[model samples]
Target chain A: MKILVCISKTPDTTAKISFTDNDTKFNESGVQFIINPYDEWYALVRAIELKEKDPSTIIHLVHVGPAENDAIIRKALALGGDEAFRINSHPGDDYYVAGQIVNLAKEQHYDLIFTGKETIDYNGSSVGGMIAEFLELPYISLATKFELNGNTATITREIEGGEEVDEAALPIVVSCQKGMAEQRIPNMRGIMSARTKPLKAIEPVAIDPLTSISSFELPAPKQGVKMIPADNPEELVRLLHEEAKVF
Target chain B: MSVLVFLDQAEGHVKKSSFEAASFAAKIAEQTGTEANGIVLGEVKDDLQSLGKYGIKKIYHAADAQLNQFDDEIYTALIADTVKSSGSNVVVLSNNFNGKAIAPRLSVRLKSGLISGAVGLPDTSNGFKVKKSVFSGKAFANVEIKTDIKIITLNANAFKVTEGSGTATIENITTQIPRRKVNVREVNVVKGEVPLAEAELVVSGGRGLKGPENWGIVTDLAKALGAATACSRPVSDSGWRPHHEHVGQTGLTIAPNMYFAIGISGAIQHLAGVNRSKTIVVINKDPEAPFFKAADYGIVGDAFEVVPKITEAVKKLKGQK
Candidate 1:
């Protein structure tokens, strides 16, 4: 089985999020970058598990970004990916990025593709579905649990108030979230092997981005909390009504 | 061309998030000086006309029983055809489960620019610019869509539903359905539980609540406020709460009108999920609880005592037992 996992780099979860230059750009000055948690913990880990189950399964990690993202791609390889592919270009727009992935998926003819439900930074959650559409393949989003039985794949996804059990054949796409797999840390052996593993950087298919970032802005600072004594609980209710006017 | 809005439904009724999508589409229509129309892919039990108050001029419904269950492939094909036939330059959807699954596929099929989790209406003063949250609600990005056709999925609770005097006219439309590769084997419907996504208010607990046995305070407060119950990651990870009830960056992201944090210390991950809430109230015994920093109201007291008092006060205010 040929499985490809798409990964991205994001600011560490504990990093303080801020904007810069009149709030027109993300401030990366003091930020530490790591593999996006969803991609590392769910999508990549699940593919590694699948490869572990079948010795012949090949897991290739693919990323669409500039050379700066290669370190994160290598981290994915150290975690279990057999090789890595990096598109040498900046991620301009979601559509442009999806088109790049589609180009690679077509060339590779991967049997299965996995991506996090959404990137923590962009939070677009659009790539997997777009890739599926461009390839005319079956796609599932936010899958919590999954099982493979021969050519049939069973997925359990959380819906509004219930769970939906879905089944599809091989050659599918899945956007994974929590409960799909646990996080795995790279050991010394894996890191050493990753150093020798092939990391390929290729040119992107020339295409104009459908959208461009005009500017960025930070959310307004929240006001100070108004404290009402624990004894005066009704006053809190009154405040919610008159001051917050939420009710 | 008219703006096309996809109204999402669950079980048989329209979802509250879909109303927001409709309102957003209508506002865009008003801004662009065009009309807004609606489309329902599945059989709906709710009155589709009453949706006109949100400013939809007409609703084009495809009451196909086969579409009762979500098949994104079929949905994407159906919606793409609908957009083409309707001559819609822009398509709108709520950034909910189904919308998330289908919008991108539709965008790819139609070769249109798509923006997900849009927080504000477009700035059409120049070229079309839509503001959306990036970095998980930490910042906003104004994106200019260069594609002639655009698709936008509105963030849940970002746009308010407004009621107007006009009633919508329900128009029946027909389109070709595509083959489905995925088959839903079974659906386990959870009844009587408040859906955390559409809840206007939420009452969430954390490790400070002690254990699952001490969860009554959370539920009591939720019940008094008619809100859904949620929990932090640690509580869910430790088996004190169900995974679905976990609200954080990795869990479900909700933007309710009000979120009451009883015992959560407000980790950045937890705040990433619920920070979009309109109003937040925190009640933690510890004065240094991080949640207090983001809360609109703070009560530095024990949850054991403060929760019940607040519940009683809410019950009294609402005249509930």
Candidate 2:
């Protein structure tokens, strides 16, 4: 089975989110970039789990970014992907990114594609579904559990009020959420093997972007906390009713 | 010109977020000098004409029994066809799971530009630009959509639903419902009082609550306030709470109107998922807990002492005492 896992490089969760260049672009200065936690923890881990179960299964980590993202791609390779592909272009929009992934998925004829429900950077949660649409394949989003037998794959997706279990054929896309798997760090041997792993960087095919970022700004700072005396529950109720008007 | 809004429904009732989207689309239609229309693709039990209160002039129903359930491919194709048939240049959807799944697919099929998680109306004076949250609610970005067909998926709680004094004309649209290759086997619902994501209020606890046995205070408060229950990632990791109840960067993102954080330290990842709440109240023994910084109200006390008192107060206030 050929499985493609799409990963994105994003600022660490702890890093204070800020933008540079007069707030037009994200501030990369003094920021540590890692493979998006969702992609790394859930998508990649699940893909590796499949690879471990079947040695014949190949896990390919696909990324859409410039050369600066290679180190993270190598880190993903270190984790468990058998090979990697770095599309040498800045993903302009969700559609462009999906187009690139669809191009690769078509060329490789991957049986299954895995991705995080959304990238921490964009938070669009649109790429995986868009790729599935572009490839004309079934897509299951926010999947927590996945089982593949024969040519059919059964997936459990977390919906609004409950869990929905659905079955799709091979050549489908599944966007994994947090409950899919626990986070895994690359071991010493796995890190060493990653150096020898084949990582091919390819230029992206021509694609048009339908949207552009007009501007960006940081969220307003939260107001100072209004303390209610711990012993006085009535005061808390008063604040809820009069001040916050939440109740 | 006509504006089309997707009315997402489940089990025969319209979703709350869909009402907001309907209201927003109606306002957009007013701005663009057109009539707002709605498309519901399922078996609806509600009176379709009553939806006109949101300012929609017409309601399009594709009431195939198979459409009662959500199938993304079939729904997307159906919506794309609806847009073409209605000559709708602007499309609106609730930014819920269903809308998120199908909006992008419709965008690709129609060659349109989409802005998901739209928080406000587009700034149409200069160009078609919509404001949306970025960096997991840590920032905002205005994205310009320069396409013939424009799509906006409004965030669940971002817009307020408006009521207009009129009735919408119901129209049945005929179209081929694409066959979904996938089959839904079963639905495993989390038996709870409140729907977490759509809940107006949420009561969440963390490791400070001690263990799963001590979770009653959280549940009691949530029940008293008619709010959903949630827990920090650590609580879910420790098996004190189900993973579905975990609210954090890696967990479910929610934007309830009011959020109550009990014994939570306000980790950045957890804050990322819930910072969008209109008002936040924090209760913790540590006065310097980071959560207080982002909280609108705080009580410096132990969870054991604080939660029960608040729950009692709510019960009394609601005349349930």
Candidate 3:
């Protein structure tokens, strides 16, 4: 089986989130970056699991980002993949990013493709379905369990209040979330060998972004909390009804 | 051009989120000097005409049985076809599971600018700008869609659904139903539990509650307040709660009207997912749990001691004896 995993970098979960450039761009100064958790811990790791079960399976990682992001792609290769491709461009928007991934997928004809549900930063959750639409392939979003059988894949995905078991043929795109796979850390040997993996940097296809952020705003800071003593828990209910008016 | 709203239904019933979407679409239609139309796929058992109370005057119904089982590609194509024929300049839906599945594909097909997690109405006084939460609700962004045909997916519970005396005329439309590549085998829906997505109030517990055996604090309060129950990552990971009930950075991100966090030290991972909640009430034994900083109300106490009393008070206030 041949698989392609989509990887991207996001601010570390603990990093302070702020906007710069008149509140249009994310402030990257001194902000640590890591492979998006959903991608690394679920999608990429799941692909590596497939290869581990079947050694003949080939896994390739694709990321659409500028040159600075290629380092993140290399780090992904350390987890487990045969090769990596970095589309040399800043991710303008969902359309452009999905279009670039389609450019690579069209050429490679990957039997399966994977992406995390969404990036922690933007949380668009758009690119994977867009790619599936561009390719006219089956898409299952928020999949919790995925198992491949001969020419068909059985999956269990989360819905509003339940789980739906589904089956789709090969050459499908899955937007993975938690419970899809366990997280893995790259060992010393894996990290050293990742340095020498074939990392190809290709130019991105020109595509115009359809939407742009006009300005960013932060939520109003919470005023000091009204603390109710443990001895007076009933007072909390009164405040919720009379003061907060939420319940 | 009419504003189109895709009425999301489940088990032949319309979801509350879809009504919220309809209300939102009506506002857009009013702003654009047009009217809002509704669309529904699959068979709906509800009185479709009564939905006009939410402001949609006309509805397009494609009651194909196959559509009851959602397939993103098929739904996208069907919605696209409706947009083309209905002369809709804007499409609206709830940014829930179905919305998240089909909105992006519909955007690609129609070449429309799409905003998935919209929290408020468009600011059309200037340009077509939509306000949405970013960074898992820690911040907000005003995004401008530069396309003539735009799509907005309102996040669940962001807009309230108000029913008036208006009645809609339901028009059954015929469209070619495409074959779905993904086939669903079994659907196991939990019966009678409040779905977390559309729930206005939620009661969540964390590892501080300890074992699954002591989960009564969450369930009792949730029952009394008529709220859904949720859990932190640790509780879910430890098998105390089902994965579907987990809410955190890697879990579900919810924006209910009110959230109660019990015995949880609000980590950024957990807080980011729920910071968008309208009001937060945190109950913990530790004095310095990070959740207090982000909470609207705080109680420095043990969950076992405080939760029962709060639940009793809520029940008493609601006249539940």
Query: Stretches of candidate 1 above 4 Å error?
Result: none
Query: How far in Å is the alpha carbon of A126 misplaced in model 2?
Result: 0.5
Q: In every candidate, how many clashes are there?
A: 0, 0, 0
lDDT of 3 by residue, B197-260 (tens): 7889999999999899999989999999999999999999888999889898878889998999
Per-residue lDDT tens digits for candidate 2, residues A1-247, read 9999999999898878877778788888898998988799999999999878888999999999999888999899889988899999998998888899888888899999999988887788889888988988998988999988878999999888778999988989999987788898799998999999998999999989989998898777887788888899778877787778887
lDDT of 1 by residue, A91-172 (tens): 8887888889889899999989999999988889999998999999999888988899998999988778767899999899
Cα displacement (angstroms), candidate 3, residue A126, comes to: 0.8
Clashing pairs in 2: none
Predicted candidate 2 versus true structure: per-residue lDDT over B1-321, tens digit per residue: 689999999889888888999999999998989989999998999999999999999999998898999999999998898899899999999878788889888888998888988989988898899999777777789999989899998987888889978799988987777778789999877676677877889999998988899999999988888899998999998888888899877777788889999999999998988999999999999987899999999999988987898889888888996
Top candidate when judged by lDDT against the true structure: 3
**True lDDT of residue B264, candidate 2:** 94
- Segments of candidate 2 deviating more than 4 angstroms: none
TM-scores of chain A across candidates: 0.96, 0.97, 0.98
Q: lDDT of each prediction vs. the true structure?
A: 0.88, 0.89, 0.91
The candidate scoring highest on DockQ is: 3
